[model samples]
Target: MSQPTIRALILDDYAHNAFREAHIERPQPQAHEVLVRVVASGVNPIDYKIRSGNAPYAMPELPAILGTDMAGVIEAVGADIKHLAVGDEVYGMVGGVRGLPGSLAEYLAVDADLVARKPKNLGFREAAAIPLVFLTAWEGLVDRAHVQAGQKVLVHGGAGGVGHMAVQIARALGAEVFATVSPGKRSIVEGYGATAIDYRDEPVAQYVNQHTGGKGFDVIYDTVGGQSLDDSFAAIRLYGHVASCAAFGTHNLATGSLRSATLSGIFVLLPMLTGVGRKHHAEILGYATRLIEEGKVKPLMHPQRFSLGEARQAHDAVEQGTGIGKVVIDIA
Candidate 1:
C-alpha cells in the first residue's frame, strides 16, 4: 500500500507569488524522530525573506515547504524516542531551512530531540508562535548574557519578534527590564512587564542615564541589528554583556572592547541547519513551556488568522509588519 498523503503549500520559486497548494506523501519517522500532525505554523521574518530571495544563505531547493515554527499532536514516535508518545502535543523549530522539510505541511517527521511537550496553557497557534523567537531570546539572554536578578537589562526593538521575547525572558529571570520601542508601541513593552523607553525620543546615552543613573545596562539585547547593535555596545555597562539574534551586519567592537564587555550573537537556526546542538533547542523550548504555564511569558499574537494554503498572506503580514503580533497559519 502507498503511504498516506497530506496537503501542503509549496514554494516553487523565489517569487512573492510562488506559494502553491498540493498534496504530497506523508513522511515516516526515523529512529530518533517523531511524526506530528501540525495544527498550526508560525510566520516569521525569515520565512518572508526566504520567499523574496533576500536570504540567500537560508535558501532551500525549489518546491520546498517553508516554515520554521509549528505545534501539533504526535501521530507516531520512532523507536529511540522514549519520552514522547502518540497523542502527545509537541512544538519546535523543526525545519523549513536547508534541505529539511519545513512545517508548512500537514505532517512532519522531526528529530525527537528538537520536539518538546507544548505548554498546556497555549493552543497550537500560540505554541507555534513561540519556538524560534523564544529560543532566540533565551539563548541570548540566559545562555550568553547570563542574566540574573537585579541586573539592569535593556532590549532594543522591544516590539519586534525576538525583542518582545527577550524583554519578557529577562524580566522572568529576575532582572529589571527596560525596552526601547517607539511611543506608539510603549504599551506593548509595558504589557510585557517592562519599563518602556521611547527610542525615538531620546539618545541611547540619555535613556541609559535616566534609567540607570548613567551606569549603563548590565545586559543589552539588540534584536534590531545594524545601528541598534552599535547602540547596544554604547549602552552596556563596563564589563557587561550584550547579545543579539540579528547581528548580521558589519560591527565595530571598539566601544565594547574599551569597556571590557562581551558580545554574543545568537543564530537560532544553527540546530536546524546542522545536526548538532538540536537537543539544546528542545531544552530551551521546555523552559519556555514553564514560563508559559507560570503566566510569565506569552507569545504576542496578531489577531488575524490564515489557513495552511494562505502561506503567502502570512508571509506578507510579517514582511509588512502590518500585524499586531506574530502571524500564524492554521494547518490542522
Candidate 2:
C-alpha cells in the first residue's frame, strides 16, 4: 500500500515569502515514535527567524516545514511506545529544526518521549499553544529555580508568550508572583495572580521595593532578556536566583556578583537541538497538562486564527508585537 500524502506549510527558500502550503509525504512512526494527526500548530519568533535564515541553528535543509509546537490526536503508535495509544490527544515541541519535519503539517512522526497527553480541559488549539511556552517556563521556574511557596518571584514581560506561562507556573507552585508588563497589560498580568508592574513607567528598583517591601524577589525570571535581564540582576534580592530565557545582550554581571545572586539562562531548544533531556521535556508537558486540567493554568490565545496557508501572516503578527497571545495555525 502506498503512503498517504499530507498537507504541510513548507519553506522553499530563505525568503520572506517562502512559506506556503505544499503536499508532502506523510511520515510513519519509528520504534519509539508516534504518528500524530495534527490539529493545530503554534507560531513563535524562532519560526520567523529560521524562515529568514537568521537563526543561530542550521536550517533543516531546503523546502522545510516550519513549526515546533503542536496539538493532535495519535493515529499510530510505534512498537516500543506504551504510555500512549491510538486516539490519545497529545501535544509537544516536536521537530521544525535539524532535518525533522515540523508540526505545520497535517501529520507528524514524533519521538514519544517528547510528547505528553494533552489536558482533557483544553481543545486542540489551546493545547497547541501550551507546549513551547509552558516547557520554557517550567524548565526555568520549576525545574531550575525550584520555586517554592512563599518565595517571591518576578517575571519580566509578563504578558508575553513565555512570560504569561512563567507567571502562572510560579503561582501554581505557591510562589508570590510579580510580573512586569506595559501599563495597558497590567490587568492581564494581575489576573494571573501576579502583581503587575508597568514597565514603561515603573523603574525596576521602584517596583522591586514596592512589591517586595524592599526584600526583593527571591526569583527573577527574565523572559525579555536584553536590558530587562540586566535590570533583573539589580532588582533581585541578595542571594536571589535569576533565570533568563532570552539572554542576548552583553551585560555586566557585576550587580549580580555584588548582590551574591546566581544567574541561569534557559534555552528550551537544547533538548531538540542536542537530543539530550528529551524526556524531561515530556515530563514538563505532563506537568503543564495537570496544571491546565486543574484550572491552575490557561492558555492566552489570540482572537484571530490562521490556516497553514496563512502562516506568514501569523509570523508577521508575532514579529509586529500586536498579537495579544499565542498565535495559532489551524493545520487540520
Candidate 3:
C-alpha cells in the first residue's frame, strides 16, 4: 500500500527567505495526539526570525515545516483524547519549535493538550491569528499579573501583535486599560476601549502622571522589550505588577525595586521547548474561546490575504511589519 502524502511548504535552508512546495507522508495521531486538516496558518514575527536563523532558542532543525499557529478540523482522534472528537474545529499554537513539526502543511498530528475548540464566532483565519499572540498576552496578564476589575493596566506597544491582545484582554477583565502607540496608530488601540498614549510625544513620566495621577499603573504589560521594559519599571505604582514577554538584555531593576514592584518575565515558547506546561496552553486557549464567543475578545486580521503557495509573502509581511494586523496564510 502506498502512503498517503499531503501537500506542504518545506523550508530546506535557514539562509533563504522562502519555502519550497513539496508533498510528504501524512502523519497519524499518537495516543495523545490528533490528526488535523489544517485550514489556516498564522504568521508571527517569530516565524521569520526562526526562518532567518535569528531565534536560536526555539529554532527548528533545517528542512523543517515551519508554522506555529493553526486553525483546523480534527480528522482523527487518539485514544486518550476524550474532550475532543473527530470533526471538531480546533485552533492553537501547536508546533514549529524544536522537535515538533509545524502547521505549514495540509495535515498535522498535534498533541491533544495544546489545542482548544475554535471560537464559534470566528472563522479559520481569525482563529488562526489568535493563538500565539493571545497565549502570550494571557500568560502575562491573567496568569502572571492576575489582572482584576477596576485596576489600571498599561500595555506598551499596544498596536503590535502581542500588545494588541494584551490591550483587549485587560479591557475584558474590567481593568481601566491604557495603551502606548504612535500618533497615527492611536485609533487602533482606542477602538479596543483603551486610552491611547502617544509614547513618542509624551515621555514616560508625563503620561504616568497625567493618566495615573503620578501614582503609576497598577499593572504594566510590556510587549516591547529593551527601553520599554525599563520604562515600565519607572511607570509602575508601588507594589504593582509588571509582566514582560520581551525581557531580554541587561536592565536596571533599581526603579522597580525602589517602588517595591513585582516583575515577571514571560517566555511563551518554554512549554513547546521543554514540554513541561502543555496543558496550561490548552486551558488558556479554552478561556480565550469563551471570551471570544462572548464577543469580549476578537482577532485583528490584515487586509491582504495569502494562499499556501504564497507563504513566503506572508512571512515577509510579518517580518517587514507591513501588515496592519495579524498576517495569515490559507492552507486549505
Candidate 4:
C-alpha cells in the first residue's frame, strides 16, 4: 500500500518568486488538529508580503506552501476534537506562518482550535474572506477598544480590507461609525453603514470640527499607517481609545499623551506565530459567523476569480491594489 499525496503550490525561495505546483504527501491530523479539504483561500496583504520576503517575521522557510485564510470541510478530526466533526464546514485564518504549513494545498492539517463553523449564509469563498480581516477588526474594536453603543468610532482607510471590516463591526456594535475613504469608495464604506469622510478633501482638523464639534471620536481604528496613524492621534477625543493594526512604524505620542487617550497596537498574526491565543481566534470567528447570519456583516468580494494555478495573479491583485474587494483563490 502507498501513502496518498496531494497537489500543492510551493515557493522555493523569496524575492518575488512565483509558486510552482507539486505533489506532496497528504498531511494527517495530529492531536488537536483537523484535516481540512480547503475549498477556497483568502489572500491578504500579508500573503503577498510573505511571498515577497518582506514580512520576515511571519515568513515560512523555503519550499513552503503559503496561504493564510481558508474555508473548507473537515475530512478528518484528530483526537479530542469534540466540537467539530468530519463533515463540518469551517473557516479560519489557520496557517501560512513560520512553524506551520499553509492552506495552499489540497488538504490542510490545521489546529482545531483556530477555526469556527462557517456562516450558514456564506459560501466557502465568502467565508474564507471573513476570517483574517474580521479577526483583526474584532480584536481591535471589541477586545482592545471596548467599543460601546452610541460612541463615535472612526475607521482610517475604511474602504480597505481591515478598514471595511472595522466599519461594519463597529456599526453592528451600536457605535456611530465614520470612515475615511477616497471619494470613489465613499459608496463602499457607506454601504456598510458607515459615514464616509473624504480624507483627501477634508483636512483632519476640518473634519474633526465639522463632524465631532472639535471633540474627536470616542474610538478610532487605524488600518492605514504612517500619516493616517499620526492623524488618528490628532483626531481622537479626550480619554478616547485608538487602535491601530498598522502601528509598526515610529510616531510621537505627545498629542495622544496630552489627550489622555489609550493606544492599542494590533498584530493579528501574533496568535498564529506564537502558540498562545489560538482558541481566541476561533472564538472571534464564532462571533463573526453569528454576525453574518444575523445580517449585520458580510464580505465584499472582488469580481475577479483565480484558480489554484492563478494564485500568483491573486497575490498580484492584492499587492497592486487592482481589486476593489477581497481577493480569493478557489482551490478545490
Which is superior by lDDT, 2 or 4?
4
Q: For residues 152-243, could you state the per-residue lDDT of candidate 2 as single tens digits?
A: 99999999999999999999999989898988888888999898888888887788778888877899999998889989988988899999
Question: lDDT of each structure?
Answer: 0.90, 0.89, 0.94, 0.94
lDDT of 3 by residue, 221-317 (tens): 9999999999999999999999999998899999999999999999998998999999999999999999999998878889899999999889989
lDDT tens digits by residue: candidate 4, 70-105: 999999999989999999999999989898888899
Over all chains combined, what TM-score does candidate 2 have? Answer: 0.97
Q: Show model 4 residue runs off by greater than 4 Å.
A: none
Residue 317, candidate 4: C-alpha displacement in angstroms: 0.3
Q: Which ten residues in a row have the lowest lDDT in candidate 2?
A: 15-24
List ranges where model 2 is wrong by over 4 Å.
Answer: none
Model 4: weakest 10-residue lDDT segment is 11-20
lDDT of 1 by residue, 1-332 (tens): 99879998888888653788888999999999999999999988998888778887777888788889999999999999899999999999988888778999999999998889999999999999999999999999999989999999999989888999999999898999999998889999999889998877799889989999999899999999899899998999999999988889998899999999999988888888878899989899899999999999988899998987678888888988876799999998
What's the lDDT for candidate 4? 0.94
Worst 10 residues of 1 by lDDT: 11-20
List ranges where model 3 is wrong by over 4 Å. Answer: none
- Candidate maximizing TM-score: 4
What are the C-alpha RMSDs, in order, of all predicted structures? Answer: 1.1, 1.2, 0.9, 0.7
